[model samples]
Target: MKSEYKANSITLAGAIAMGTGVMIGAGIFALTGQIAQLAGPLFPLSFIAGALVTAFSAYTYVKMSNAYPSAGGIAMILQKAYGPTTIAAAAALLMALSMVINESLVARTFATYLLEGMGLKRTGWAVPALGVGLIVFSYFINAAGNRSVGLFSIVMAILKVGGIALFGAAALWAGGVSFEAATDGQSTQIGGFVASVALSILAFKGFTTITNSGAEVTDPNRNVGRAIIASIGICVIVYLLVAFAVGSSLTLEEIIAAKDYALAEAAGPTLGRTGFYLTVLLAIVATSSGLIASIFAVSRMLAMLTDMKLIPHSHFGMKGAIRDHTLIYTVVIAGFLTVFFDLSRIASLGAFFYLVMDIIIHWGVFRHLRHEIGAAGAVLVTAITLDIVVLSAFAVLKWQSDPLIVVISLVLMAAVFAFERFYLRHLRDGDAHHDSHAKT
Candidate 1:
């Protein structure tokens, strides 16, 4: 019914811009140093490796969207694969929460760079305050409507990419640093490299945001897949270049030391105060736009879930528009996360949840929905295998370094499933009565 209700308003370029905006947000600017610390001189390679894994992960989305295009998107796919049962509800919520986690991650990144550029201290409440303020601002923008979000995404995407390109080029030009410095003279650990690849996978995870916009994109069938492929391709090139520039400019130790503000720091050597200000300006724009786009997608996702009767709804003294309630809920949770966690912890939690959710998606497609979607069994199997391998490696690494985050991720996942089961049980008789009335 939602597919029939709303007209296609997003152009192909708009869709691609939305995806790129989300991917390029906090990822390269924040995670480059983190990845560098883990992968050492091979940090750039981790992004390329992540892109390869993303290609496999994306195959499931392309096949499903081509077969069944809807704004419901992944939620619809999950229902088709596992029925409108607990698995569908829980897995969909996992994705929604993962996006929420990313919002807080981007917000914190915005605050960190903003403070650093101003030559201010990053300690105490400064970071969280700015982060929460941005979340509130994005909520208001999302409440304005889709057209505003789309236009802003397009503008911000262009500006952010150009700014990043300039930073990379100018830094490389000014420093004249060699590739050997960035890619050599370090002890490389296989496990750490694999784990870092998992983090790099998070950097490009924004491509899936396009699938969530299927019902809104013009020519959903063709454009959804096209936008996704184009987004990933463009991001791969951009991420590789930025990683090289950062690595070339700063040693691994320097990068890790200023991991939270690496991009702005990278500017100090090349363009001095002016470039730092410019890079900071772009980061703020990118993170703000990323928050707006993510809020738009996740709010729509939860609304779709409610429409399908997969989740409960609450008017909460507001109008009956599900998007309104979901929008409020998204900002509140993201603000809470931004207040409590640092960037690395938030990212690790998000990556853990997302990889697990992605594994479920691949499993659903491979084991049950592959034939219906006309997907190759081999490709589906390969996708699932890769996700599992990466997820396991990342989990081991997290367990060693930050076992608390791993525990939090597991407990949160369990809570989602448990809550869904209880809610479904509570509504079983009512659902049966509604079903009987409809049939009659």
Candidate 2:
């Protein structure tokens, strides 16, 4: 019934706003400095490269949606390709978990910038407390309804996009930024560029949230693909401008030094205290909107999984549909993640899980259902190949730089499959019992 409530409510612009809100919220504010660290003065180029890679990844989801648009999004694709098997269920679960991880990342980003704007130090429970508060706020807003989510996304998307443009324009007018330092005429390593691309890919990964909400969008069959493409285009341009503004205003060292709050830091030089407040306000808007849209999408996805019997569900004495339970579950998990992990680890974990799940989706489309979905074999192969190369590079880098999160990602992925296997066994046993009872 709640699913029915959302049907045909989201317009094309709303869909684009949802996708843009998620991608921009997740990436630009938090990742500009981290990307600059890896890509040097050419950090903007990393976003360009990332946009290209994201297009390739988007191709499969778009093609699949064109053929079979469902609210199930990734899970629906997996079931279509693999026929409700363990692989489909596991990959779907992985996607759901990655989305939850993304929510935590956005929430933390909100806390970080909010504290920076307030001129408060980030220490002990303060950051997580603020992060959890944001998540809680988003949860309440999301629980209101899909229409509320869509309208909020549009408003925030407009405000944040405008805010970013103003930040860039005002900073450029300040005129002290050195593009020479951005390039510095240094020969950067191809590996470092590739690693940055991998992270940059994470920044645009929010586009998939559109696909997750496919069933809710008006004219989803056609609009889902369009929304995905439009969201990516809008975000790519915004990210490039922001990257340049940050790069020009701050030295590579400065960017890295304040990587957690680079956008706000960039404001300090150009717009003075007023600009700093504005940039921080923009971050709050983006991250808050992102958390709202993400919670809406992921809750629907988990509810779909439960409805399909791929995942078990319990009401826990709640009143509404399965989505209500899933919403609570999603927020609880994300809150725990926010409280425990810092920004970098939260981001790395999200990227790792998403890339792996993305590879799985591409493989499913290419190997099992290419003909049915009207997907190009060549495009799917290219997408899968690039995901593997970048994901491998990212993994190696993470293994060296911060191995603990890598371990957590692998262990969690393994646990998803293991749990699915046991669930499948139970399903088979229950069916056998029903068959015996009918015979009797």
Question: In model 1, how many backbone clashes occur?
Answer: 0
Reference-based lDDT, each prediction: 0.86, 0.85
Model 1 bad stretches (over 4 Å): 1-5, 180-184, 433-440
Clashing pairs in model 2, backbone N/Cα/C closer than 3 A = 41-182
TM-score of each predicted structure versus truth: 0.95, 0.95
Model 1 per-residue lDDT tens digits across residues 4-64: 3364888899888888888998998889888888788768899999999999999999989
Question: Which segments of model 2 are wrong by more than 4 Å?
Answer: 1-7, 180-187
